[model samples]
Target: MNRTDDISNLFSRFGASADSYLEFGSQFDYKEKPLALVPATPAPEPVVDIAKPVIKHCDTPLAEAATDRVPASSPVHASQSTAPLRHLLAEVARARQAEAQARNEEALRQALPHGRPAKTRAHVIALISAKGGVGKSTLASALATALRLEGGQTLAIDLDPQNALQHHLGAEPDVAGMGNASLNGENWKPLLLAGSAGSLLLPYGAMSEDERRTLERYLDNDRYWLAGQLANMGLGENDVVILDTPPGRTAYLDQALMVADQVLVVATADAACFVTLDQTERLLSERVAMGQAPLCSYVINQFDSARQFCRDMHEVFKRRLGSSLIGVVALDHAIGEALAYGQNPLLEAMSSPACQDMLLLSDTLKTQLKSMDVAESYAS
Candidate 1:
C-alpha cells in the first residue's frame, strides 16, 4: 500500500475516526485550505496571579511552571532606579558646600574692609570696673547709642551674668542673650537685639548654675575662645564693639582685655569707688608693662559738682589720668529717669548734661581711632 494510505489505515486502527481522516484528506486537495494542527480537546492552562511572588500548587514541575508563567510587563533595572537618588544626593552635598563657602567669604569680607589685611582687627572698646553699682552699664549703653547716632556701627555686649545691660538698652527684661547661645553652641547672629539709633545689643541670657559653670570652664580653658567668637562677627573698620563686663576680676574681664583695643575704666566719685582704683590700676599695670594691654582710659560717672569730695576726686582723676581722663559724666536725675522709663538717655535726653557728656566721650573715642588709623597708615 501507498505511505499516505498506510498512515490513514494506522490512524483508523489507533481509534482515529473515519470523518477525521476524510477532513484531513480534504485539506490536501489543491483548492482547499490547510487544517489547523491543534487538538480538539486540550487541557486548560494553570492560571497565575502575577501580583504575588510565589506560584500556586499545580501538577507541573516547578521549573516547567516557572517557564510557563508570564513575566512583568516592564522589568526594573537596578541602575536606572538608583541613578536619580545618587544624583539628588550629589546635588545636596554641592549645595551645602556652596553655602559654607559663601559664609566664609562673607565673614572674611566683613573682617577686612577697604581691602585691608586681616592683621588690622576691629577696634574693641571695653568698659570695666572693680565694683558694681557705679552706673557702668548705663554709661556703656549710652556711649554705644551715641556712637551709633554718629553713624558708627556699634555692638553692645553685656558680659555680666546679672543680665542687667538689656534694661538700659531698652530691651525686654526677659530677653535671651549671649550666655544661652554659648551654652547651646549656637551662632550669635540670631540673638542680637535692636537698640536705640541702629545699635545692636547682646544680653547675658539667664542660665542655670550648671550651664554657667560649663561656660566658665569653656572660657577658662581657652583664653582666645571669646576673642575667636567675636572675630567671626564680621565687624568692619568703623564698627565699634562695647563690652560691659561684670565688676571685679572675672573671667569675662580677662577675655575682654585679651581683645580690647581700648579699655575704659568706669569709676564714680564715691569713696568706695576711689579706693578700688588703686587695685584696678595695679591689675592693669602688669598688662601695660607686658605691652599686651590696650590703651587705657578712665571715665568718672555720677559726679556731683556740688559735693566737695566729688570735686576733689574729679580734680585728682584729671591730674592722675591727664589726657586719659576722657570725660566726667555729671550725675543727673534725668539719666536714672530715662533708664527707669525704658528709654535711651542719648535719644530721650540729648540735651541733658549726662547725654552731652556721653556724646563728647563718643567724639573722643572717634578721634582716638582716627589718630590710630593715621598712625597705622604711616607705619605701613
Candidate 2:
C-alpha cells in the first residue's frame, strides 16, 4: 500500500479532497481497485518510402500571349492554380483559432469570483532571535493578541520545540510534541489556541524524521504547503497570520522570515543581545530591505529604567536601533502573573503597568495592520 492507494480509498470513501495533502509525499493502501488496467502490446514503427518531387508548370499561356489581358476579364484558371495563395489561407485560419482560444480563456477567468479566504485576516509574522530564551515567543504572542483585538483574524504559530509559548498563553498546548501526534496523517491538525477576540491559534507540535522532512518544504513557498493547505481551509478570513520561531538561524527560520508580513527582532538591553541583533540585522537584510519589511519593530523585554545600568543600556539601544525601535516593554511581574493564569494581560488586569504598555503597543500594531490592508488593495 502506498500514497496513491490511500488517495484512491479516500476518493472512494469520501468525494471531498483530503483535508490536507503533503507538499512532499503521502501513504496509501492498494487492496481496493476502482478498475483493472489492461496491458497493451507495443506498436511497430512505420517505414517511409522514398519519393521524387514532381514539379508542374502552370497551364497558363506564355508571357507574350496573356500580356494584353484586361483586369475584369482575367482568366479564372490562373487564379485557381496559385498554390502559394492556398497555403497562405491555411496559415490565416490557424492564427484565428489560436486567437479565439486565448480570448475565451481570459473571459473565463474574468467570470470566476474569488472568495475571502479563511486565512485572509491571518497574516504571517515571524519573530527572530539569535539565541534561546530571549523572550521572542513572549513578544510574538503578545503582538498576536494585540492584532486580533484590533479586529483582525489571527493565528499564532509557535514553531519552537519547547513550546515555551504555552506558559505565556496560559493554556497547555494541544500538541504535546511529535511523539504524541503524527502529522504524516490527515488527522494531525495544528492545535488551535482559543481567545476572546478575532484571533485563533495553531501550536506547532513535534515532528518525526519523516514528518519533519515533509513539513520542511512548506516552510517556504510551493515546496511546502502548510500556508496554502491552511489557506485552502478558508482560514484566510482573518487578515494576518503570525509566527513565532525558535532560536538562532536555520533554513526553516529563513523560510518563515521570507513569508513574514513583518519581523520583530527581540533582544535584552545587554551587550550579548546586541550581538544577536547584529546577526539578526544581517539575516533580515538578505530577506527584506530597509523599511520594506512593512513593519519592523524592536522589543526589549524586561526593560527597567530605575537601575542606572538598565537605563544606560536603554539609551544605547535607542541610539542604535532608532526608528526601528517600535516600543519598549518594562519589566513587570503582572505579565508573568497573567501567564500563570492562562490569560492575555489585556484581559487579566487592565490597570497593570505591563497591560498599559501592551495596550499602547497593540494600538500601534493595529495601525500597521490596517495600513497593510490598504497596501494589499493597491498592489492588487
Candidate 3:
C-alpha cells in the first residue's frame, strides 16, 4: 500500500472512518439501470442468472409477462404506503446536512476587530502622604473606587504595613486575611469591594518574620518590581493601579515613587505638609536627574476653599511643586464619611457635591495619565 493507504489504515484503526476514496478519486455510475439488491439475509438461490452477463443500461426495461416481476404504478413495493413519508424525510435530512456543512465552513474564517490599546502607559499610580492621619488611605480607596466605576479596571495595592485602608474599608487585608495568598506563585484571593465596578484591593499579604525580611531585602528595588508583580496579577486593558503607601520617608515610599508613572502626594493643605511636598519633589528630582525615578506629581488633599490656610497652601504648593503639580484634591465631607464608614465616596457618594469635586480630580488625573501614555507611544 502507498503512504496514502497506510494513513487511511492508521485512521481506520483509530476508529476515524477514513475516506480512502479521496486518495484515488471518487467513482460514479451514470446509467439508470435498476440493480436488484438482495436482502441482508442469504438468498436460497442466485437472484440474477449467472448465464446473463451483467447488462449496463441507460434505461430500465419493464418485465413483459404476468409471471415476471413488473412494478405497478406508484411502485407498489413491499414498503408501500411509507413512500411519500420516506421521500419527504430523505429531502429534509439532505437539506439539514448541507446547512450544517455550510455553517462549519463559515465559522473557520470568522475573526473580529482587535482590542483598544492601553489607555495609560504605566499602569501603576502610587499615592503617598507627607504624614499620617492626613487621609492617604482614604484618598487611595476613593480614587480606586472612582476610577473603577468610571469603566476603568482598578486594583488598590495597600503597601502600608499598618493596613489602615484595610480597616477603613472594613476589608480585612484580603491578601493577608486569606493567609494563602503569596508572591511565591500561589493562589491569591483579591479583595473585591462590594460594588458594581470591577475594583479590587491586594492587601499586603500575611508575611512571617522570614517573608517580611525577604520582602524588605527586595524593598529597595520594589518600585519597578511592584509594577511587574502587579502586571502578573492578571490585570487587563484600561486598568489603573493605585498604591496606598505607608506614611513616612521610608525606603518603601522611595520604591513607590520610583515605580510610579504618576505619584500623587495626598497631603493636607498646611505649611508643614507643603514643606514636605518640597522635600518630596527635591528627592524625586534628584533621583530623576540620576535616571533612577519615573514621572510624578502632587495631589494636595483636604483643600477647603473657604479656609484661608487651604487657599494660601494651594498657592505655596503650586509655587513649590511648580509645573510638577498636576491638580489639587479638595476636601470633601463625603470622602471623610466614606472613609469613616469604610466606603469609596466617589462611587457611592457621587451625587454628593463634595464627591463631585473628587470626581473632577479623578478625571483630571486620568486625562493627564492618558496623555502621558499617548506621548510615550508616539515617542516609541
Compare the candidates by TM-score and give the number of the best one.
1
**What is the Å distance of residue 344 in model 1 from its true position?**
1.4
lDDT of residue 328 for candidate 1: 88
Off by over 4 Å in 2: 1-121, 149-151, 174-182, 185-191, 195-199, 206-226, 289-294, 341-343
Q: Which residue pairs of candidate 3 clash? A: none
| Tens-digit lDDT track of model 2 for 1-380 | 99877886786687666645555755865586668487777799755544844435656677844674557666688667667876899999999999997885676445433432233235666788787766677776776676663333666766776667655665555555432342333332354656434345556665566666545533422323333344544554345566777888865576566456777777778878876777777777765563435367787777877788888888899999898888777888777776776767767545777666766776777677678878889999
Q: Between prediction 1 and prediction 3, which has the larger TM-score?
A: 1
Q: Per-residue lDDT of 41-152 in model 3, one digit per residue for the tens?
A: 7759747878877666635346444434444543554666566777899999999999996774455224211322223333678887768877777777767767642445
TM-scores, one per candidate: 0.66, 0.59, 0.58
TM-score of 2: 0.59
Q: Report the number of the highest-lDDT candidate.
A: 1
Tens-digit lDDT string for candidate 1 (197-311): 6678999988889888868866766666567667667667877888999999999998888788889999998778778878988988878886776888898998899999889
In candidate 1, stretches whose alpha carbon ends up further than 4 angstroms from where it belongs are 1-120, 149-152
Evaluate residue 185 in candidate 2 and report its C-alpha lDDT on the 0 to 100 scale. 34
- Score residue 30 of candidate 1 by CA lDDT: 67
Winner on lDDT between 2 and 3 is 3
lDDT of each: 0.80, 0.64, 0.65
